[model samples]
Target: MKILVFMKQVPDTAAPISVKDNQVDASKIDKYAASPYDEYALEQALQIKDKAADTKITLVTLGPARVREMIMQGLAMGADDAVIIKHEPAKHGELVEPNDLDGLAVANVLAAAAKKIGYDLIYTGTKGVDDDQGWVGIAMGELLGLPLVAGARSTEVSGGTARVLRDVEGGKEKLEVSLPALITSSQATEPRYPTLKGIMGAKRKPVLEWDIASLGVAADALASRVERVALDMPPGRQAGRLLLGEPNDQVQELVRLLREQAKVI
Candidate 1:
């Protein structure tokens, strides 16, 4: 079986963040190994590969050269190979610069890259923590003509089909799908860390590169522009007042303020 995992590089959460010129100042951010949500997708892929050692699991990502670091992490976690769509770095942001791709455009590029791979199953993070747009997998599935299952907590593959369990707002639901479907994983599932040997082995695994021209996508497909923007931090919230007094006094004062002064009850 051939499986594909879509991955992405994001600003490390621990790094100090600031909004400048309406773009994230990521130059000084200390990059983490991989995204937490995508880690669940990787873990699910590894688990699938573990059961069937013959399974070929590959990864795909989009970003600057530093993004390959994330692909390497997936390799270390036991994905057999990888493909990285390298985006040119810019002073502001990729969205503000060339290949002006939003989350949907990025998804378009990914769909183009995976179009010919003929993967039996595709795995992805339910949502990117950085963007939180939750469009990539759905967009790819739409472009590729495959069924989509989001918030997947567990999955099973058999006879060229998949049985998935997805976590909804209040509970969970099950879906049985044929092969060649897309599934987005969430924290309802657990991801595995790489073993030392797996890390060393990943160094020699294949890492392929692709671009717009090779992927046969038009400049228009990635054509998107910027508009209204905000370049500063939101005003910090003021501390709340602490009502300290006799129980009855505090209640009376609170009620009066809510009803007469604040006009909110």
Candidate 2:
């Protein structure tokens, strides 16, 4: 079985966020890392590959040149090979802003790539950690004319079909689909970190790079569905006040502060 896992490099969630010229300022970020949910998808693929003989787990990411780091990390975690969809021009070291590519364009390019190389199953995060645009997997499925199950918590494949369990409002929903399907993974088992040995071995693994033109996608045609009119940081938080003394006294003081100073009842 050939399983394709889609991933992305996003700004580290713990890093400080700042906006400049309506785009995230990369300089302020401490580092870039793989989107958390994408890692879960990768882990799921790895788990399956561990038990299934003749299975190959290949990772694909669409981003700027720096995205190679994210792909290498996945390689270190045991993916057989990787494909980097170079979003930026062959400008060498420079990285394009993540906002430059939207979900529609990403889905289109991914669908095209999948067609070029057939897969028994495809996996992706339900949404990207940075943009939270949860459209790519479903859109790719639509473009590829394949069945898709979103928010899958667990998946099991057998007899040329897959059984997926997904969380819902009150319970979980079970679904079975034939081969050549897509799954948007949600919260599941924790992702495994790359070991030192794995990291050393990853350096020898194959990492293929391809440009947007090579993917048969036009640069200008990827118009974003949502336009950013302005950008600003959220208001900074104020220092908190401590209420000392007895619990009853604190409750009374809190009420007074809420009524008089806060002006909320």
Candidate 3:
């Protein structure tokens, strides 16, 4: 099976968030890294490739030129090839919220690219670590007119189909679908990391680059569905509230508050 893994370039969650000029000021954010969740998706594809010798794992992403760093990291992990969608990182305050960009435009370009190559399987992380929008896989599925099994905790590909188990709000859901499908893996999923030799060999693999002009996802063709109105850092957190008293006194006071003041009861 051939696979395409959808990846993202996300802010290093480790870096503190700073808001300036009504933007994230991500330019100043230290250590841009692969979206943490996308790491799991990359690992998932690698594991499948290792288990199936015929499988070739490919990576694709839509972002500015700087996104190559994450794509290289994905290559170093075990992807056989990569595709970078070169476009300036559009300001969220100008267009749509960063999370909401997982729509027809981006999805159409990815679908067009992947369909050109003809893949049997596609994988993406459950959500972008930065925005946590949880839409790309579903959107890709829609654009490709394929089925999507999302938030999968585990997946096994066999017999020309994929078996997936996903966690819903509070329970698990099982799905079996034919090949040439899209799946989003959750944190609960486990995929093996690239070994030392695999990492070394990755340097020799292929990475295909394409521009918006080549892919036909021109800016004018991408109609905006939403626009960002404001951007700001979260307010500083307040100190914690502590309720203290003897055990019996605390219980009595809590009960009184529940019944009379707080009215929780």
- Put the candidates in lDDT order, highest first: 2, 1, 3
Query: Candidates 1 and 2: which is better by TM-score?
Result: 1
Each model's lDDT comes to: 0.79, 0.85, 0.75
Candidate 3 off by > 4 Å: 90-102, 188-191, 218-220, 240-265
Candidate 1 residue lDDT tens string, 146-182: 9888878888787888888887779888999898899
Candidate 2 lDDT, 89-128, residue by residue in tens: 2321343355576778788899888877679999999988
| Candidate 1: Cα lDDT at 191 | 69
Per-residue alpha-carbon lDDT of model 3 for 3-26, expressed as tens digits? 999888877888877766565666
Each model's TM-score? 0.88, 0.86, 0.83
The number of clashing residue pairs in each candidate reads: 0, 0, 0
Lowest summed lDDT window (length 10), candidate 3: 94-103
lDDT over C-alpha atoms for residue 82 of model 1: 91
lDDT of 2 at 254: 100
